[model samples]
Target: MTETLSIGERVAWYRRRRGVPQEVLAGLVGRTADWLSKVENGRIELDRLSVIKSLADALDVQLGDLLAEPSLLDWTPDTLGGTVPKLREALMDYQQMSPLLASDSTSRPPDLEILRTEVGSTWSAYQDARYARATRLTPGILAVAQHAVRAYEGEQQREAQALLAMAYQGAAMVLTKIGEADLAWMAADRGLAAAQESGNLVVTGSLFRSVAHCLLANGRPTAARDLVVASVGYLENDLADASPTYLSIYGTLFLVGAMAAARIEDRAMVNQFLAEAEQTAQRLGHDANHMWTAFGPTNVAIHRISTAMELGDVQIAVDQGPRVDTSTLPLERRVRHTLELARAYSAQNRTDEALALVLDAEELAPEQVRHHFISRHLVTVWVRQRHGKPSHLLVGVAQRLRVIG
Candidate 1:
């Protein structure tokens, strides 16, 4: 009956109500038991409306039943596989434990050097599209970083808090992508508070970027664009002497701003932000992942293609899709771009092209692409228009996405 149950949890609830075993239901739905398990645990997104309808038919219930939100879980600890619930517990646990530990001056904190490395690793997981796994790690990382902030001295304390801020931002980034906008906002707010305490401009801008991202996910790209436009000045400091880190974050913020403009179909703001992004990307000259922002010439070109898609210029997106070299992009970025290209192809009535891109993206990052809410929708739409049975290959992929029974 909860209003916020995630797609997976609702599926689980409906299945349980029907007294369906996971294996039996998987068989009925033409999906594997493992796939069903992942969906039930929230490892897979139940996004595509067609697939949800298919599930409703297979489970003998209304689609609305499976679409209901989950019962919110408290941190008092019943086991949870979903990331955000566990994150809530970790955040609450750290807030309580850090202050108590800080009261005792003699208690030794975690190693600062190690914590920094873990923060870097956490970012890697996020960039690789291991979103759920990243969420699972972030709260613990945040807790440790917070502990270090209280226990360390002077410069070390600042670095600890900054790393703590990064952890929160990482949580926000992953959560937003996974459709947890409210929780993403909470994590972003936490990051901003910690960044302010650390007095780091780079962290502050990065956290602002996270806040903007949460806004976009909540379907307010105009507000998101406004946020990026207003806060653009925050990163302007030290541009002349900007390190690769600064250039990367600066370019990424504009890239985000450009994306926001695209979502709301604000062509003028999109061009302006993209122009600014181009300047920053050109300054870098080549692809470089400074602070995991992955800002550079190639990334800028990719964003241009994405922008065109957002603007409903499908021809432009299709034209640009083949020209760009995708070899240099990260797995997650490449997969997302490929999927976006598929969307463009779909829009253009190029079913074969769209299907190819979807398959390629799925091959590259199955967990990311196949489990996305959009993936199912894409596959479902693709299937419905076929002259007859699709090729075996397409059906295999559709089956994996649970788009066909």
Candidate 2:
């Protein structure tokens, strides 16, 4: 007979499968490894539904899969749906509390558990909306995240500050994906500031990496490189600790280095950075599954494709591009992979393939203005190579995009 696993045992099993040690998993989940061990052994119980769900997500399993009885498929709708609206209202109130707290300490404060409960509910709702691509929910979620940061700052709570910074970073990443570069940059900056004020070097370094990514996506390669270089000293010191945050920052710096080298047409530098990135990733393993480093393997592979194309290594690009599983990635990242493949195909004089890939990307993100910019850049390089006649399709798309004069 198969062993019956309690929720805690399921969590432990999944954590081990993910290659995360108990201590490391505990850090990511904001608890002690001893506590997690007791919970896994069924000697302790946790009442926070949100924490349980978060743990499930980190383990790449559904909440139902992690439960002992596993019979609550329909039960969540009643338990969660009825509470969402009130939770949303409470989250908003918490957001508003930041500004109030900044100005007036005499005001009575809600319990910490209350804030966590509401934030957890709001986060679950946001995740559902995110997967559905509900654009309307983004702004509201972002507002709440901003408020959380401000409130944490007002209260001078280190853990709260780190969590709030993460919330802002997640919002900014979504905004960036949806073609709001300016707003994303603003949010990233705010998160960085909060991280610095909290005196968490790990959070600060990670936020800098996010800022560099926004700069890179906006076509500011030089600025991005400078930001990455500035992060090197901090990352070097932090990496010795075996912290997941350090691994994330170190990997991100390598990615930034690869991109910068590609921009300047330095093949050797690109290869060096990619190699370093791979080494760091191997050392870190899946055990370091902090949200800060979620981009690891996928990010490294994407940059490798881009770098290979820039260096005219067509075979390398072709071989590596198809190995990536774009379906596991977000839509924004999938669009980027398509754009890179288009460029790589064009480099090999595969004009038809190039055009097909670009068309697919355009269709996927029709309303996203930045995709057009990327398309124009790829088309310009392909045109320069004299791979094909400048057809009406190219001219029409470019004109509609207004990216090319």
Candidate 3:
């Protein structure tokens, strides 16, 4: 019944149902009554997931309740609302918490090779932007990874733990993409614990990226930045003979740090981090997807555009976004950067170009486009602000995104 209403309408309804005063609710989320009023009246758009989560907390409702994402026709089965519970169940399985429960005399020994291959497959699907397929694959991979970690002994056990850590890292990333930031944090924490058990510095550093991403998703950018900085410091002493794996992990940390700094509008730190990342990329000397980090000169350039966008230098992003060729990158990276460029176009009132880019991105990865908040919000604003007749292209995209019936 609530699905038909806009987010603001739902907020207003929930606020009234709870008998909460506007001022009180507003104060709870650190906003003024006037701000809340604008939100409820749909005069302001709630683009930030952090703000939406805060309102949900203040209203004593689930985040999904406030989001009220209309189920898209093509993607409903694997929607965030539909898929997160299964992943949550897998992550929360009691057997993983107590490995002894998973051990049995009749059970077959876990096949380490199969488990490793499945983990790699999961990440490959994810990098291809097949989020639903990746999401579906994660629970099984995690279950097998946990079993492998329990079944193996000595060095094999450590190897299994590293694989488990990578599986959890993949899970955390998928959760973040689906807007389950809290769950993502839990997955990252689990990954970090597994990484420590493996005693692998590279795995630990990579898992740090997952944790930082969760922090950024949860709107704790300062904490995210600090975490990345510390992680980099931990790896600082080993750079003398750093492998491509180390360079990728080290450089990607700086990229994530740049993003975190950008969120807080820390101009100096943003520049510092970006410069550090670029230097690391140059040392690597070419585009490579080492450790699935996608750390290279091209990737660094992509982050520069992203940081610029985050810092509200829309002109810089607008100027630099189009020239960068992401053709050699993973499908996920390519599509994401495309959406970022679309957002810049929309911000500059180049609606036609923005719409075209969105269309192009949707063709490349329909699931990603449907699930991304930026695309959804952009379509919503375009629909709301339009006059007598909307563009058919816009209407088609909106319908596919479930922004309108």
Candidate 4:
């Protein structure tokens, strides 16, 4: 019944249904009645997730109840919609819950090498920004990893646990990117559990990165930052003789911490985290993708741009964003950096450059820009703020993203 209405109209319907007056609802959400009226009348776009959530809380309703569009396929691919449920089912399967109950002939002596190859291939697809493909492959890999953990014992069991951790980490990464925040957290938590069972500190640190990302996706940046800090402290003494994988994961934690701090406007922590990450990058002495982290000197520089934006230092982001060369990075990293820079350009009202960058990102990965919150929000803003007939380029992008009819 609400499918045909704009988000504002939906809000209005809920407001009326709950018998909340405009002024009373507005006050509850810390807004004026006039503002609420504008929102309800579709005179304003509710773009911020935080504000949307606040409104939901005030109305005593689930967030999805207000956002229950008939389909996300206008922006999200069918691949995502189809695969997420499969991934969830795989994660919640009985085999993942207990190894004792999973002992059957079909699970006996599974090929570890084949499982490792499948896990690695899924991560590679994720790094390349083939998100839908990666998601499609996750369920099978997760199922195999679970079976391996169930079948093996002693040292082989530990090895199987490591594989399970990596598989869960990959699933978490894809889920986070596609805005499946709750499922992402579950995947990360499961990965962390597997990593601990494997008794691999490096893998544990890497899983901390995934957990921190889930925290950030769920708007708990402070918790994310603290987790990163604690994980780094736990791993700090090992860096003296750390392998490239250890260094990469260690440095990447600081980067994630910096981003988390930036979200809360914690300038001191942000600076401290960036400095630590940069020093680690210098120690490593080059760009590297150790353990699929894509962490090193170049990545540290990219984080600086990301943190600057998060801290609302838009000019700094604008100034330094274009200087980094991301060609050596994975396609996902490269496209992500491009989107951040485009966001900065839009903030500075350099609309042409922002649109061009958005187009460039689309050319590189059509699914990414369409599904990304940044590109979708920026395009929506551009379409709304335009005075006259919008440009064909802008219209085309918006249409593909389903920001407009």
lDDT of 1 by residue, 1-405 (tens): 543345666778888988999998888878999999997775564543445655776788754455431112222222246556778777667443467644545668889889989988778887787766687678778877877888878888888888888888888887766556677788888888988888888888888888888776655677889999878886786799988888888888898899888876678988999999999888877899877787888788888988887676879989888788868877777877788788878877787888888888887766576445456556765565567988887788877765565
Number of clashing residue pairs, candidate 4: 0
Q: Which residue pairs overlap in candidate 2's backbone? A: none
Best-fitting candidate, scored by TM-score: 3
Candidate 1 RMSD to the correct structure: 10.2
TM-score list, all predictions: 0.77, 0.57, 0.87, 0.86
Candidate 3's TM-score: 0.87
All models, RMSD in angstroms: 10.2, 22.6, 3.5, 3.6
Q: Write the per-residue lDDT of candidate 2 for residues 1-405, one digit (tens) a residue.
A: 011334566787888888988898788778899988987775554323345655775777654445322111111233333322332343345434366544434444334454445434433433332312323333444444444445444544665566556555654554454444655576678677767766777777778877886775454566776777678766686566666667876787788777766765667777888998888877776423354354567767888887776565779989889788766554556677788887677656687798888877767764342323346545544443344667777765554444344
- lDDT on C-alpha atoms for all candidate structures: 0.75, 0.59, 0.84, 0.83
| lDDT tens digits, residue span 134-206, model 3 | 7777887888888777777999999999999999999988777766778888999999999999999999999
Better of 1 and 3 by lDDT: 3
Candidate 1's error at 159, in angstroms? 0.7
* Candidate 2 Cα outliers beyond 4 Å, as residue runs: 1-139, 142-156, 174-181, 217-219, 286-289, 325-331, 358-372, 376-405
RMSD (CA, angstroms), candidate 4 = 3.6
Q: List the residue pairs that clash in candidate 3.
A: none
Q: Candidate 2's C-alpha lDDT?
A: 0.59
Prediction 4 global C-alpha lDDT: 0.83
In the range 144-207, model 4's lDDT, one tens digit per residue, is: 7887877789999899999999999999998877777788899999999999999999899999
